[model samples]
Target chain A: MLRRAASILAISALVLLVAGMGISAQADVIVIGEIAALTGPTAQQGLQERNGAVLAVEEINAAGGVLGKQIKLITYDFKGQPAEGVSVYRKLVQQDKAVVIVGTNFSNVNLAMAPVAEQLKVPVLSNAMEPAVTTPEPGKVNKYHFLAQPSSIEQGAIVARYALDELKFKTAACLVNKGNSFATSQAEAFRDYFNANGGKVLDYIEVPAGAVDFKAQLTKIKASNPDCIYIPQYAQEAGLQVKQARELGITAVVLGANTLGVPPFVEAAGSNAIVAGTYFINNVHFGDPRLADFMARYEKRYGEPVITTNVFFGYDNVYIIKAAIEKAGVAEPEAIRTALENTKDVKILQGAGTITLDPNTHRPVDMPAWIFKWEADGTTVPMTLMYP
Target chain B: MLFQQIVNGISVGSMYALLAVGFSLVYNILGIANFSHGAMIALGAFFSYWIARYLAVPVPVAILASIAFTGLSSALVELVTLRILRKRGQGSLYFFIASLTVFNLVTAVLVYISRGNIVSYPRAFLSGTFTIGNLYIPWIDAGMLLISIVCLAVLSYVMFKTRFGLAVRAASFSIKAAQLMGMDIDAIIQGVFFVSGTLAGVTGALLGVKYAVYPYIGNFVYMALFACVVGGLGNLTGAVLGGLLIGLLETLVSAYISSAISPALTFAFLVVILLLRPQGLAGRATEEKI
Candidate 1:
């Protein structure tokens, strides 16, 4: 009976913690719920996403939040674990009564939670471009599950065009980190698009996430003498890869995913390791006055100015959600979903162009991509706009 | 290509050797596997980087100061936590848990402080490269190999040639016997922790220069404890051999075979080696008294 009592107490405490911590989901206040990775190995990402969300939310609240009902953002940090994401989302939907759920960052969690969302009949949108998240059964696509950002197929096609046509590189080699859904899909997209666009891929290598050395990988690629190298990896592996590749004297005009434009990448490739000819999928331009103003405000809030496709999507996700809620004129779950489906030509504070979420694949249309270069002083400056 | 990979392996092997020596010294003498020893090493590694780059101190001064700082911290760790646990008459498992908690706490703090940003600093001591037989080995690699040898020699002298060293070994092997023989257990243990922590600091410095401090990257360092165990638990010389063997196997597997296969390969090798040579490579066999 003592043991059973202890178990009951423990369960009660857990339930309390979950409910108490859950952001308020009420009809009077339009509460938008987000499940993001706020801690763990990819903890830096949380800072960006959270801050961007704050800036967007703050702007909305300052100018009357969601048609005079203050938009309350209730976030549950997943800490980059699937189990945590699942638990957090369950509480967020059931306990918090969250009308709509945004993301848990990585596609794996979103894909896993898709069924749960469908069961609950809540609209689920994620920033990750993983194909499996959208079309889970390969053929059967769920109408409830939607993706706000361009899918990997669309993003990869733009990146490939930037590499082959705009840059005019005849031969390119791609190095992708193995076991990563994002890396694998982006690599496949790059390979497919490059081959289709009459460009040759010299070698495609998949290294692990925790690999410390890239000298051997660079040596083999160097021997192939590819003029351009494309690496699609997260900031962690890509940081070391960028540094080690330079240290080994492989200074080929390199192209990377949006991850290359982040802090870990700049901090890792400091002093001499930062190669000048490096280009990445840069959505934020330092030259544009409006982007500059947004960056200044972002810097004032976040203390460092770094923007990515993910953060832009994250910051923009709020306004679009707000727009949808306002259009619906009610805080109903189905109404919000319908409102989101109809959102068009909406200007998100963090993006260069207006993002329009296409209702079919649930991806944004006309999401432009750019090629940015790293300076010797460790600043990632916008080099050129590659594809729009 | 082969030579380069070997040089790369040996260079990294020096790190393993340094870490191995630190682990061996503490475990053999303290009768406790200070799991915080990895975080201690990482903490030491970044201390110098913080001084040299972050605080604008000279590299040499930063290196020496950080080593001493880590040593002091290690000693305080012993005084505040380990010593209290020891006084409770519990086994080393007590220290093990305390040390593990301390490591986790320190790592959590480090993550909180650095916010997971990988920081790098230039060391003037190791800044260039030399080419031999189509392999360009960084000067830092050669420096690590040299320092590793020098530290081993110094540790050997302290263990075999010094009176305090004898007391430490005696206290660990047979605490009652050593106490009856009038050895200063506290003094000896303190000395051992200091030496162990100092070596960890040096290893940490090498790490900061080699690879920028990534949060919780020493996770693999704890995994090296298995190497130490397979080397015969708490045997100093065996720990060294185990580290070298693990390092060589890691390099070879990554080069010749697939990198993914090495985790299984190393585990299987260790299990097989333990089965064949239960006493470990350089472990001493005990005599039967009953």
Candidate 2:
């Protein structure tokens, strides 16, 4: 009798929960889906991305949200897995009824989601740097997928050119993380550009993923004596590499992707003194006068200073969706995707001036990358903006 | 460059040795791989970090305190899980699975506590490198080598010279026989766990200093397991030799050959070694005791 009564209560509670969810899914609000690595190795960046998106949504709704409706964000943790990303994408689109999806700076995850986005017909605006995320083959594009930042090819070539032309580096070594598509794509581009353009690449070393020790590899690189080292790894590995390189007395100028500017890199390196003077290609110029307000607002909201360029990626992604919705003149997935394809001069944070996605490839065209030098005090000084 | 790589290998090998010895200790007694040693390693790191950060203790003092704490935690784990299983006359297979589950649970709890964020020590413990000739050796690596040697020496002294060590050895030879001879079986097992946990704590605290502190730092236990297998499952000296060999092989392979395939090549080499000597490098073939 007691068990029967408990079962009835449990059934009624579940019914009430479902009913509550149904009521919250109002027609008055436009639902947007976001996928991020919210609870895994990359959770730090994912949380920053989520926070940025939430902040943008809050501000957008305050100014009377797009298409005469308030914005509703439904975020799911991808847990840094590509398969999980696909399932979450499906859940958000099919169950949550989202008009657009934003997120995930991880290239592999975005690559996995590209085909699913095409089939679902829901536009995805991502910060993943790999060009293959949007364009699977040369001259072929995934119409539903869009990239916010410049692709890996462009960023890689830009850094290579900066090293060769501006820094006058005659020799370089490339240390790549073989498992990460983001790192490999950049390293390949850098190597191709550097070798073709009067710079000799001494050695190209590929390390396994999640490796902490680089002393042996660094020892080999030291023998070759390169003018600079191009390390295209995530923040953790990059930090360790730089630290180990410095310890081994390899004083070559270390260059890396945007991950170098994050707090994790500095923390992993152990000391600012170790990372000082290292150059990196960054997405956002933190020193920009324009970003001052956003920085202040972010710190106030999160109770911590902005750690990575992911914050801007997350913030701009929501605004990009808002622009698409406003351009399409409707809160619908198909309409928003088409509008996103034709997106032009949308005023958003990150990069210079405004964002414009090329209709042909669905990637930002002629997006310039910011080059910064790490300071001894653990801050980055903006040096120059390079265009590829 | 070859000499420098060798130095690097030895430094790396010493770290593996520290972890492998701890793993070997539990295996020596129970004959079941105590995978919870991994959890103790992670706990050692986290406990030291918390003590140093929140309690504002000196890093050395914090490490020492964490070692004791982890030791007690390991004994408590045995008291709860292995002790009860022994009482029920359960097989070692159940204990093995229970240990792996404990490792996962601890890692998950740590992940929740840390929010999956990788953190460094609050202050620099052993920062910077001092070069001997053209070969650069970081103070942390040198310090770790010294500490590892001291730990092993102390462990050896305890294992061979002490009364408890006699009991442990006798138990390892035959637990049933040791019990018949009026030895306290449970106490010996608990003691072994405490000692193993202490070794894990030392390795964890040092590893956190060398690298960064993260919940997944416990993954180093895989290397420990590998070292134990290569060194001869029940032999202490073999565990140490196996660790050094693996480290040296990894370093030399990465330095001379391809870095990407180094792990594959190292494991392949290990497989070849195993095939040649089925009893392992230091292990002697013995009849299975029923």
Candidate 3:
């Protein structure tokens, strides 16, 4: 009778174990697809966006994941190409069945991915700061679309203010790449403010990108005798201009957009001659004493100091996702989106910077743009803290 | 002041001549464009950058190694991408397509391997400014000019004086014919690729050391393409002249008209030349020889 009772207990335990395993398997992990120009021209930008997303996901998982299950972030390569970005987004939605997506660092690529996201009704958190991403028809845009970064208009206006108030330049020359959204928007903002502020407009030079040299623009800038030259271009082309300008003895403040803060621009331009300052709406400021802990953890993992906001963006993004998941209290997309929208003051990377959401703007609450200058020793130093 | 722009043109032109000559040699000898030529260029720079970052070699030694690495990579390309596909019945179309795919794959593989970080040379290589007259010559530009002349002179001597070089010339003319004569055809062909690849590598290294190295940077070789076109595709002398001329043209455009139209000027020149004289600057047309 004891032997029979023991056998019954063992079989019952086995059944119970199997049933528990079956129930756990039923709670499926929701796939979150991320597409970025992980490689190609403008690669650094893509890298930052991808890094930010990756870090966010990791933090999300570390903080008990989303819903009762862990998120599966499926990343795809679009190589900064519009068509490729579209295809990648489609694949993520149709084949991968990713509940939500974020991607495409380039404005054009982001715009391309927008239609696909709208058609599929998948909430897309675009990292592209292009003005068009928010306003599709200049006024009409999708309600579900969200952007982590502020618009190019804000970036342009901030830069314009810096050039006028801070730099105190009389005449400024503008080197605008006629092809890109960042260049065009910044150029517009600079024009509106600089001229209105009683500064002489030297020359509005439109340079076609990848044209090898910028001697003509330099010559024009030289002739105009501008106190400064505003370049709303990335580091690759921007480096060439700064180098060429200095080469021609045209000593003027060469200002650039936030993209200029990257290492390639500094390396390309060299140190002493080409001085540049840029604004970034980053969550983590390098000078933040609160970031000391985050930095320690980051350095411990990567074996290097996190100087730029690139790594911080990734690290904080992870926490943002974590907060959203916690708010949702479930892994469901609708619940997660609500949680993300409701996320406020949930600090992970920096002990500061509240992640507040306003229903009117449909972006994070009161993003701050900080200025950083490349130091003599090849280190990016925090210059000014700003709210835009 | 205008003189300064001209000098700038010459410096950049030298770089193109450096790149175009190697490309022209590969095209002439192999009877194939060797589209993966960019890989050799990039690798040369990659090697130089690595040397600067890790070993901290002087620029001169780095240049030499860049050439050798590029040459070896070129030979490797032939081994992996060309040799198997080469057949009597088959033309260069097979090699061309295979290598185009090879080019894309190599680029993809390189990027995947590096995770697309911009690998740059140490700043010490090209930091100071050397002033000659009113013109301020940057150390980097000065270094590029010196390197170009040294490589070009050495290449000339090798091609004219050395027996290995003669074999190379023979192989390029007609591989079968050269084989029929007393010559090791395979060795000659391999040597051509190696030599040509080395030249491209040197150019790439120079570019990386002086400027910066991200992935696929060789695509920005503006002067090389124009030089190739102007030099009649496979002519060495023509390549040099073409590179220098285009370099000057670009500088002039940048100095006077607009820097934005410099690339457009190159294409416009190509179109005009093609329409008027498709045979090229020094390219011969032998239709109905008397």
Candidate 4:
């Protein structure tokens, strides 16, 4: 008799929960979804991205939201896995009824979600660096996917240009993780550009992903005596490389991608002195005048200073969606897609200035990569900026 | 350069040796793999890191504290999981599965608690490098090599010269027979786990000092398992040999050959050696006494 009563109570609770969600669904608000790596190896970046987006939503609703309707964000954790990314994308589209999806910063996850986004006919804006996330084949574009940041090809070109033209590096060595598409593409692009621009590549070393020890590779690179070394890897591996390279007495100028411009990398290096002389190309500058208000608001909300440029990626993506929603003048997914394709001169954060989406490839057009150096005091100072 | 690479190999190999020896201890007597040893390693690292950071203790002292704590934790794991299974007359497969489950469970809990952040020690311990001729050796690598050697020496003395070691050997031969000879079987097993866990704690703490500390640092168990298998299962000396061989092979292969296929080449080499030896590098063929 008690068991039967308990079952009835449980059923009633579930019914009430569903009914509550249904009432909220009918409210005068537009639901946008985010799939991020909230708990995994890359959780640091994911959490920052979420915080940035949430801050934007709070500020937007405070000033009255887009299209005369308040914005509601529904976020799900992908755990930095490609399979989980796809499942969450499906849930965000089918069950949550999100008009548009802001996807993960992991290139592999974005690659997996690209096809799903097209089939579901919901546009996905991502900061994943892989160029293949937006363009799958030659002269073929994944129409439903949009990249908010510069792609790997563009980032590689910037690095190569900086090394060859600005830094005046004559000979370089490449240390790339072949197992990761992001690292592989960036390394290949850098190599091609550097060679074409009259710079010599001493040796291109391929390190398998997740192999922590790089002393052997660094020793080889040191023996070759390159003017600079390119380390196109995520922060953790890049940090390890930097630490080990210093230990092995390789004093070549170390250059890395956007992922290396975060606090986690510095922390992982154990001492800031290890990374003091290193250079990395990033998308956003925390010192930019445009980010003063955003930075203050972010620190006030999160009780911590901004750690990575991922914050800007998340913040800018929401504003991009808001612009599309206002231009479309409707709270429908299809209309938002059309408006996003025609997006132009929309400013939020990062890039050279205002963001303009390419009609042909659905990616940000001509975004500049900002180069920064890590000072001995553990602070990043802007060196210069490069555009491609 | 070659001498430096060799030194690097030996340093890395010693770490693998420490991990393999710790893993092999529980397996030798229990006749089952304790996959939870990996979790114990991660726990040791995080525990020492927390102690050193929050309590402002010396790193070496913090490491000693973590060793004791993890030793107790390992015995507790056995008290809850394997002991219950053993009481139920369960097979080795069940114990293996339980151990694997415990590893995953511990990893998940750590992820939740830490939010999956990769953190390093507040102060660098055993960092920087010094040059001898043309060879550069990081201080941490030398420290790890020294610590591993000292621990292995002490472990050897205990295992070969002590009364408890005699009991452990007897238990490995036959648990029923050991009990018949007036040994408390449960106590003996618990003691072995404590010793093994202590070793794991030391290894993990040193590794955290060498690299960085993260929840996934336990994934190094794959290297430990490989070393244990290639050396000879249940053989402490073989585990050390296997570790050194694998580490040296990996470092040399990556240095001279293609780094891209080094892992594949290492495994292929292991497979060839196994095919030739059949019973592993150190194992002797013998009939089942049971």
Task: List RMSD in Å for every model shown.
Answer: 4.0, 2.4, 7.4, 2.5
Docking quality (DockQ) for each candidate: 0.31, 0.80, 0.38, 0.76
lDDT of 2 by residue, A163-229 (tens): 9999999999999999999999999999999999999999999998878999999999999999999
Q: Write the per-residue lDDT of candidate 4 for residues A249-305, one digit (tens) a residue.
A: 999999998888887788787778999988889988889997788789899999999
TM-score of chain A of each: 0.87, 0.94, 0.83, 0.94
Extract clashing residue pairs from model 1.
B45-B204
Q: What CAPRI class is candidate 2? A: medium
Q: What order do candidates take by TM-score, descending?
A: 2, 4, 1, 3
Model 3 over residues B1-290: C-alpha lDDT tens digits?
67777877887788888888887887777656667777777778787777666787876677677777778888988877676666444577788787667667766766776666555566456655667776767777888888788888999899888998787777767777887897876677778888888888888887776566756767644457568778777778878888887788777776677656666876787688767877668766523100
**How does chain B of model 3 score on TM-score?**
0.91
Ranking, lDDT, top scorer first? 2, 4, 1, 3
Candidate 2 C-alpha lDDT tens digits along B1-290: 99899999999999999999999999888888899999999999999999999999888999999999999989988998999998998998889899999999999999998888778888888888998899999999999999999999999999999999999899888999999999988999999999999999999999988888889999999999999889888788888988898999999999998899999999999999999987778887744431
Clashing pairs in 3: A52-A314, A56-A317, A56-A318, A67-A330, A67-A331, A216-B254
| Candidate 2 Cα misplacement greater than 4 A, ranges | A1-25, B287-290
Query: lDDT of model 2 at residue B119?
Result: 81
Model 2's number of clashes is: 0
Task: Return the interface RMSD of the candidates, in order shown, one decimal each.
Answer: 2.7, 0.9, 2.8, 1.0
B1-290 per-residue lDDT for model 4 (tens digits)? 88888988888888999999999898788777888888888988999999999999988888899999989989998899888998899888998999899888888888888888788887668889988988999998889888888989998888889999988888888888998888999999999989988888888888888888888888877788888888988889888998888989898899999888889998999999888986668866633322
TM-scores, all models, native as reference: 0.89, 0.96, 0.84, 0.96
Q: Give the per-residue Cα lDDT of candidate 3 at B264.
A: 82
